[model samples]
Target chain A: MKGFSKLLKKDLILILNNYFLYVTLFFAIFFILLVNFVIPEDTSIEQSVYVLSEYEEGNKLIDYFKEQELSIRTLDSREELMQYMVNDFNSIGFILVDNQNVEYVLQGYENEKTKNLLALNIENMFQEFTNQIDIKTTYLVENNTVQKIPFNKSIVPLFLVMEPALIGLFLIATMVFSEKEEGTIKAYAVTPGRMSSFLVSKVVLLIILGFISLFLVALTTVGTKANYLYLAAITLTGSIMGSGIGLLLSSFFDNISKSMIWIIIIAMVLSLPFASYFAPNFSPALIKSIPSYSMMFAYKEALFPTGNSSIIGNTCILTFIIGIVTLILANLNIKRSL
Target chain B: MIKVNGLYHSYSNDDNYAVKNASFQIEKGEIFGFLGPSGAGKSTAQKILTGLLIMQQGDYTIDGKFVDFKKRDYFNKIGVSFEHPNVYKKLTGLENLEFHSGMYDVKTEDPMNLLRMVGLEEAAGKKASDYSKGMLQRLVFARAMINNPEIWFLDEPTSGLDPTTASRIKDIIKRKKEDGTTVFLTTHNMYIADELCDKVAFINEGEINIIDTPKNLKLKYGKKLVTVEYYDNDRIVNNTFSIVDEAERTKLNEIINKGNIATMHSQEATLEQIFIKVTGRGLE
Candidate 1:
């Protein structure tokens, strides 16, 4: 156990000296800032126009339109106003006063929130006004189901998929291969240290670094949720599996450059296609089979209500994969002599 | 003490045996030198003894207990320094020693002390990457001594060192011997073997050509005679005489008393000449 601590200490110091920890932290933070820039926040007000005629109800509606928070501009003709709205909708939308009914004149992507806010407020005012005159007015509102998932919400899981491969796998593989080339791996073999303990230390260090990298990215690019505990579990499991992959690569490839190429290839094959930009409707079977895919899906499900399977299943599969790979690498490493 | 009997090893399934039917033993506190040219299987034998290379056939034991290569406990009792110094480039000399020391069964000495012992104390804090080959070799020597094991396995321990540093390292080996540590040294340096080894084995082509004390081999194959040189009447004269006869000694004494004797010395063959005589090939 004492020897184990010394080995762990040396491993940690090597990691620190290599600057991998700092690189991961920097990449995570910089990536967050980059993603934040790509997705701008929405704070502008909705602008639309409602037209009214000189009829009693329309006059009442005109009076009501003046009282709403909608950014309303009035014009003479609906055709001219619609043209103005199309050209400068972001700046101002027009409301026309008429007799029987009110028509909304707005640009091409305009809908209820823009069109109805003013009409509803005006109808409310006219309803109060017509109530005083013993008359009735009906206002129509189109039911629109706009899925308001946060802009970065979907990307949270995608970042989770990338975190393991981009940061964890590369770092772990590089560390192990560096040691192997330096003859430190063979040196450790002659030590009284258990291969399992040595590997566990690496995985522990990798998990901490991996989680810190992914967590910072997760927090900056997308806000954390109430169930951060669940996110952490998923992150830990993914890191373990990713680190296992790294160990397997390091154990197999003596060349660091070749190992890095393999890592990039694996990361791309597993994560890029399942990313939302490429396949929003990624097949459930494919996602379940690939390790990163399941992790990304679980993270997205946690962020939003998208998936049916629980995070527990993905976590279990990741844990199993990690265990098997780690065991194999450990066995091979222990038997590797000078 | 280390012992091996009937050791056999081959590089591959169909390859010829690198070590075959080899056996030797070294008693406690002796510097046993294995002198052989390159490709004589000296390194392979050393690796098998140190547990780096596994033996496919043999009864191998260290300190009277049979060694199971799968276990690491036997390694704690021995320290090995490779002919090629394999040190971490990015790590400082001190850091390399610290890291390797952590792998030992028993922690022994301060890394700086080991460096100082090897005349590398001044360079201890420098990165091994920036070190010269000799400095790196000294640092490896420091690493090998970090744990102070009972047995030291050195393959060409002084290969890249300067003569002074090599002598200093040899002195350290002598000190280790005085402290009752057995050393298994492998080198093609017959001079070092002649000087340091209590017993030297000349291995040629994976077989022990001769195993005996350096003095005994010299006596067995060396000329038993002396050459005398003198100047008589402003002319140089030379005479060869056998040390084996008393009459020759009397004649040399009478000549020395009657005339001038410039130089006189007995002749004994060197280990290199003796090795060439035995193996019919020069030590490169």
Candidate 2:
């Protein structure tokens, strides 16, 4: 027990003294601010003219918008409206009113939230206006609901995939390679303690570190929309697999630079496919091969609670893969010569 | 007691054997020195004895049992100080000793005493990275005593230390020997060997070139011819003389009576000079 404690204490102190906690906090706050302030602002207002149409019977879209307590103003001409749209509205674009129909125009220059909110508000007005009359205007959104994830909610997937890999690889890779370079590990090869105990101590320490990092990243970024218990389980499993991979790499490479290169390559390769916004369609075969993709998938499903079966498949695959890899690496690493 | 016979190990098939058919016995309470230059399989032999490296063709035993290199249980009976300082740089000197001490599953003594023994008591709280080369080497030597084992394997234990510190460490090793613990030391420093070892083996290129007491080696390889100076007819003269038997002694006595003999001394050799002569190579 003391042997394990000594190993854990050494690894934890190494992580703490390196200011990894500060780095994680910095990234968490930066991610939240990036989603909140930087990602949801409009850059242009050339098409901010919004129009509401009157129904055939009586009610106009403006009256319905007014009834819904929305704040919108109407102008006479497109050029005259451009000033109102630019000055009065901080949105991307607007709607144009024609006889019995309404058109929503976006100049493709506003933030994502502004574009999405304008469309949602215009549709809500039409539904409200149609309800006022005796006409039944069907809603396409009622039939098919595209998930409108808020900017705050969108960064959760990125955190889910990046946290375990970055924290695990950085901490474990540095600690193990440092030990190797210092010859402490080679010394342990002749010690009476089991090598597995050394590895297990590292895994346990890293899992705790992973959870702390997850807690920080989550409290600052994903806590509101995230399920803490589910994230805990996913992060714990992901950290275990990550520690195993780190030990495996450490077993093979004695040089710190080479181990770091391998760690960065592995982190980038795994995190690239699950980056939902940037590379969403990275081949399904590749996605299935990565361990973090399943974690990301499970976390997303757990966040949304959309009853997606991919969550079940992802969880099962993640647990099994972690189990298999941990076993294999633990077995192989103990027998490996330094 | 430690016995190693017919030990053969090669890093790879293409590489030459690091330890080939090496055999030796370390009796209890004796300081046995393995004298060899670098790349002469001294460390390899130490590693094999300490259970760090496995041998393919060896039947070695510590306290009369075959060693299982994989399990490392034999480490309980022996302690090793590597040629390189292998302490954790991130840990304090005390913490380094404490951590390694925990690896032994037994009631252990205080690590501070060991630190004090090695003159690291004041620096115990300092991180190993901040330690000088001599300080780190002392800490490494301190770590080797944490287990209080019956046998000690020290590989170039005083390599990087200053003379005073090295002698202090050697003094501690001598105290351990006084406690009846077997000490197997590997060093190229013949002066240290001559001062400490009861018996020493000179190894070169994976083979034992010579093994004997430092005094016995000097005697066996020393020059038999003695140089003598005598005053004959008031003129100084020097002559070579051999002391093989009583007849030579009589001849020398007759010459001494006939003339005044000045100075006489035996032509003895240093261990280093004898090592060079035996192996056809210098220690360097």
Candidate 3:
């Protein structure tokens, strides 16, 4: 254990002395800030609805659309509404015929499904307007505070997961290649230091750096809402898994540049969770097969739990198992390469 | 302090043996030189003895204990300086020594003292990457002595250094020998072997051709005669006389008495010549 600590200290010093660690940290913070501030957040599905009428009923209809969180744009005439609809593909035009009826106009290029959905919603609004019935009903609103997370905050875990995992892979590759190029790895073979200690030290350093990166991203984006303990656990698991992958791939190459191609390939595999995040409905079982998928999912649940303990528990278990298997494989490969 | 009997090693199952039927022994405190050109099993043998390579077939013991290369304890009493500069480039010289010294349980000499011994005390705080080639070699030598091991395995310890630094390294090796450290010096430079080794072995093609003291090998293979150069007319003339012949000895004396001798030298073979004669190959 003492030897392991010494090795870890030496590696940490190496990492801190090099600019790679600082550059990675800078990029992590920059990305988090960019995601939070630079990119506009889409809070809700807001579509502009143009109301072409000057009547009191038309005003009521505009109020109703506004209540539904739609942006209401009032036009002066039918010709203006048609011109606006032709020019703006994303906006729907509402032509009020009388107090009892209305016409919904969509652009020619708009999808049929979106056009139908818009027509149906307008029909319901006209029904509520003519009948003067309070049709607005709230369900499951008591003690079920469904906090609407911003797009930036919702995707923070994706970046956090990717940063540590990819950095872990890059770190191990550079470390192994550096020692191999210098012939210091062979020097260690002649010393009293065990291969296990050397490998463990590298993994531990990755875990530490992984935790720091996770903390920084979480703090900057999610703030106190993120479950720190769960974030740390998943980060450690991802780091171990990443280090294992890096070590395994680095053994095949004699230098870091050669190993970078494999690192990128493995990174693409690990980044499958991002695809699953952005397109949840399109997720395949293969994406879930990726180790980072479980970590990312578990992290998301920890940030916003829906009371599904079993899924999180299973993800944690699966991640832990994968981490262990990869770690063992990495140790074996490192020993053999040395 | 070291012994090997019929040691053999092959890098792979289908490859030829890198060290074939190689065997030798060294007593305590003796600087035993394994002299051979590159790819002649000198490094393979040193690697086996230093616990870097495991012997496939044979028995070897160091300090009366059989070593298993896979065991961590096998390196407790072994020190090795490889032919290349293997120190961590990012680490200061002091830190490199301290880190490696922490790996062993033995009491290590102060890192600063080791640097001082190598005339690198002022550069102890500099990163090894910034060191010159000679300075890096000195640092490697200092690192090898950190544990003060019973057996020292050095490979081409002075390959990339000025003569002054090389002499300093040789002196340190001699001092280690005086301190009872068995030095297993491996180099293709026969001059270094002749100058420092108590016993030297000539190896080529994964086999040892001869093992004896440098002086004994030279005497056994060299011509037992002296050559005399004198000023004859306007040019120099040379004469050879056998040291063991009575009339030849008188002729040498007469040349000296004539007092016009420009140069005279005994025709003793150098270790390089002796290596060529024994192995039918040049050291280079």
Could you list the CA RMSD of all candidates, in the order they appear? 6.8, 5.5, 3.2
Query: Which pairs, if any, clash in model 3?
Result: none
Q: Write the per-residue lDDT of candidate 2 for residues B1-284, one digit (tens) a residue.
A: 67888888887854489877888887888899999888888888887777666666779886787777766566676787887899888789998888888888766659999999889999999989999998988888888888887888888888888888888998998999999989999999988898899999998888887789999998898977677788888888888777776777677888878758898777878788999999998886
Top candidate by lDDT: 3
Q: Give the residue spans of candidate 2 off by over 4 A.
A: A18-47, A52-73, A76-148, A277-283, A307-320, A323-327, A334-337, B225-241, B245-266
Give lDDT: candidate 1, residue A134: 46
Of candidate 3 chain B, the 10-residue stretch with the lowest lDDT total is B47-56
Residue B34 shift from truth in candidate 1, angstroms: 2.1
- How far out, in Å, is residue A241 in model 3? 1.3
List, residue by residue over B95-211, the lDDT tens digit for candidate 1.
888877777767678998999999888888888889998888888777878778788888888898899999999999999999998998999998889989999888877777888
Model 2 chain A worst lDDT run, 10 consecutive residues: A50-59
Instruction: Pick out the ten consecutive residues of candidate 2 chain B with the lowest summed lDDT.
Output: B48-57
Docking class of 3: medium
Clashes of each: 8, 2, 0
Better of 1 and 3 by TM-score: 3
Whole-structure CA lDDT of model 1: 0.74
DockQ comparisons of all candidates to the true complex: 0.38, 0.60, 0.67
lDDT by residue (tens digit), candidate 1, A174-213: 8877877777665565555666767777777877886787
lDDT of 3 by residue, A39-98 (tens): 667756556677887576677777776787766888888889888777877777778777
